[model samples]
Target: MFDISMAEWSQNAPARARLLLVGGLVALTGVLALVFSLREPGSIAIAEWWPAASAAVAAALCARKHERPYVAVGVVLLVFLGLLSGGRSLELSFLDSVGNAVEAWLVAAIIAARRQQLSLKTVADVGRLLVATVAGAAVAALCVATGAHLVGLDFAASFVPIAAAHALTIVCIVPLVIIPRLHFRVSTPPKTIAISGALVLSVLAAFYPGSPAPLTFLPVPILAWAALSQSMFTAVFQLIGVLGGISALTIFGGGPFAYVTGAVPGIAFLQLYSFTLAALALLIGAAAQERRVIERERLALASLVRGAFERGPNGFAVLQEAASNWFELIEINAAAPALVPDSFEHSAGQWRLQRASRLHEIISRLSAGTEQTFEWSAAPGAASTAQLTITVGHQPNGSRTVVLAITDLAPMREAQRKLEEQLARERAISNELRKLNQQKDDFVASVSHELRTPITSILGYAEDMRENHGVTADEESLEVIERNAMRLLAVVDDVLLISRRNSDTSEPPARRRIAVGRAIDQCVSDLGRFAASKSVEVHVKVAPDTYLYVPESDFARVLSNLVTNAIKFSVPGATVKITADTKGDEVMLEVEDSGRGISREDRDRIFDPFYRSPQAIRDGIPGTGLGLPISRDLVHSMGGSIGLKSVLGEGTCVEVRIPLVRPEATQ
Candidate 1:
């Protein structure tokens, strides 16, 4: 009933515009008729044809233009009135003029004398204006009737039909001609009943002297009241109005006197009609309102119920609370039913049952109540059996509901178990490798110790024989023995250091603040002959006051390695420069040699344990592979970082950075 479909443009807007134009033209025509009457040519008393013609023309125009053609027809009625005074040849009678003026006056008075202000733009809103117009016409007729009576003219019931005829003309014209045009936002139905009742009352009111029937419009003011109460839907309520106006008229209506004046002349019908229309509008509006609310609430509940049931991902079912043993199934959304595997529900009465999916088993987990769940298991030959978790919520209607959520955990759980096993295996292998490494270190240390004893004894005997027998111990022979012994000692030392670090039981190296300048000076002093033999100048740059707290022996070993490397790599005429200084909280030592330097690949892994460069091996550089590793270890024991930078065939630089913790005295 509350349909918005009527809002289509073909239905109401064009009609409203036509009605607005028609009403304006009709009123204009009426005024023109009056003006013609007042003009020359027998002072308009003879211009009877023009008045009628003008009305006819205006009505035709309004009929085409308006949805309701009453306003245009009213203009025509005013023009037609000229017939009474003999076509205005003589001065038109003042009585007829007064009656016409009063009709117009009353319509304006209803608008102006309104107790509440209104902005009438909708069909329901304009319906009240139609009522007022009819009632005003009635008042004019009643007044004419009363004035005739006071002058001793006999009044007749015949006046009633004339008023009705006039009113009917308005209704027919307005509906046929106007309502399809002037555009408004709201849709409004044609006002047939309201106009009819008002027209009947208007003719009844206007002709009688001092007629109260004009007051029929008193009820129409209630339209203003609905301004707030029925804003958008006011048109619907206006289409439907208070029905029993004729009955009310008959009850209080007895004669022309009773009819022309109000039904309860002074206080009765006026108040009753107004309150009744208002109360009735409120009542009918409330009914429409109530129906709308109920529809909305019902739709909402239905949607919520559907969402809960249909959107479930897993299997679900219902069972009767009364019969627990004979479980019968009713409806299911799942592919498989797991709960009622061995059982089915009774197909009778209000209590019904349903099934669960392949992975589910109905487990009675409810303690006191008759609620339960089903566990899901893997079904064979399926991609994977859906594992399920189920819960039941009790319905107030005494139906038990089961909800199942299926989850597959096979792949995830298996992967996690494998990861744990892998970790265990790795720990076992690490333990075995550690034991083997310790044994290897011990064996190397033992062999080196025994070999060193024999070599030392041989060397001492050879030295004695060379001195006593006056045999020449040539430089090459002496150098060979010395270099071999040193190489063996280096290998022995590397093995011992690795084993000690692995056990973590070795004593930490002694630490003391030693001046950076003094340490570099001592290394250069010791390496002077070595550098001199290679014809490589060893230059020293020392920051005199610089110092670092590190083991003196470890520092000496580190510096000795750097100088020996520089001398070994330097070209005969080139220089090897050693520099030392304090930088922030650390002391930096650098050794740079100008010669064919280490290659990129060798430079990267140069300090790796037992690593020897291809160039050094090919050149028969006599040294153990432990020199760089041992130097790095000694430097690290004193908390320092050892680094190298080199370019092929250009030069190499070795740097040791140590924390500077100056002591009160230095060795």
Candidate 2:
């Protein structure tokens, strides 16, 4: 629609070219009108038909070029020249010419403003042109009547003839010139041309000089034929030819209308007939064009739908829902024919009998407007089942077509079975590894428990021998043996603790409301001898009455381990700071030491069982590496967390957070 409106002559041509075209058309129209006017024997008082006719054609062409102003100026100049060539005096000629120019300007202005191109693709386009022609002719008729009255003539006598002649001329000639140029594809089929030629010849014969008046109706059916079979441009030219033939016969006083006495009355009847025939032809032609366009679009959509359905991979079938919940097959693609034999069968019983119960469940869901999918095995009991995946979709419509798509699922099912088997094997291996780990922990626990008794006995005998015997030179060796025995006992105790914790499924320790500050003080006092032996200062900064809801023994063990590590790692003159504070329902305890800090690489494994940093090993630290892992387990068992942060060459700080017991809750 947008393309049609913008198809003006100036769209492709430059301004100068459009101007030249308009000028040439205007000059040619003027020359034709002048020649036609010379053949009229009427006085200047009568309306000159040629000037009105010529102006209408020229105005339509200029409007097509989108030059309305040029149309107005050129039309007035041409009308004036047409009148002057007919030998009219200057003053009278100018007044009459102005009226014709105004009529032409009205036609051009209306068409340009509506942006209506001079093509008849629809009935509305033809109707709009007809209305504009009538309106412009009426205004020009009034102008001609007013001029005639001033020249001492009757207004009614001149107005009617001038209006009728101008209206008929525009209806016939303007379309003849404009439609041909605007609608470029004007070819008709050979059969259509032959039919139109025959119709024109028949209309001419009907209006022959000696023909009866009843024969004049013969052209009506012929005109209808031309309208339906030929292009709109051809249909229009046929109507024009029919009108011209009637006019030529009537002018020679030979046609049926010529039998009437007066020329005006006879010509009026002929013009009325031509007007009615032209309108009918235009309507029929527009309708035919619209029908052709609709048919083309319908065929295009059908082709696209058919191609999509045929190209699909899965078996596709459409079933129409019928009475009693039965579905009748409506359409099926190529792949579907092999899946279900006897394509024209209406019942679902045949296909349903061969498929499994699962396929029936999916179809039942789809019938209720719920999309569903399920798998069907063609050979259910075979070792390698031939499976198909069927998807059912409900299409919304009066008939309620259900579209079913089927795909083979044998390959996919086989792949899924292999994956499941692999997963089962991995689970079996993981369970075996877990049983072996439990056995290792049990062995470690048994060994540590047995060694503890022997180590204690050795320590006692070493001490007793040194005290009971008289002073000897080997006293230093005996003291060294006793010191090593106590260290071995401590190591044995740590191993037993870790083993028991891992293997035992014991209940958690009872939560007791105890002052966390008192626990810190106890841990500091117990480790005081160790700190003194190393010459390291121990500082305690715990808030008074800071209480936690945790087992007192676990809290004490956690604190003792952290403080002992801090003291062991510090330099001789450095301080080990132990602080505890309450924050938002939790007790935060921190043990900081001014010692060589752990490296970034060793921090990740510091809490693992029997794991120690390389720096600690290099320094020949005197302790087992189970302290941190035991402390972490004890803290976690009492609903608390422990974390360590350190910087190389700076210091190490360990933090523990345990839930604090509120005073009100303890009461």
Judging by lDDT against the true structure, name the best candidate. 2
**In model 1, which regions exceed 4 Å deviation?**
1-401, 406-422, 456-476, 502-507, 525-529, 662-667
- For each candidate, give its TM-score against the true structure: 0.41, 0.56
Q: List the residue pairs that clash in candidate 2.
A: none
The TM-score between candidate 1 and the true structure equals 0.41
Please report, in order, the local distance difference test score of every candidate based on alpha carbons: 0.53, 0.70
> Among all windows of ten consecutive residues in candidate 1, which has the lowest summed lDDT?
44-53
lDDT of 1 at 213: 39
The digit string of per-residue lDDT tens for model 1 on 586-605 reads 88889999978889889878
| lDDT for residue 495 in candidate 1, whole number 0-100 | 65
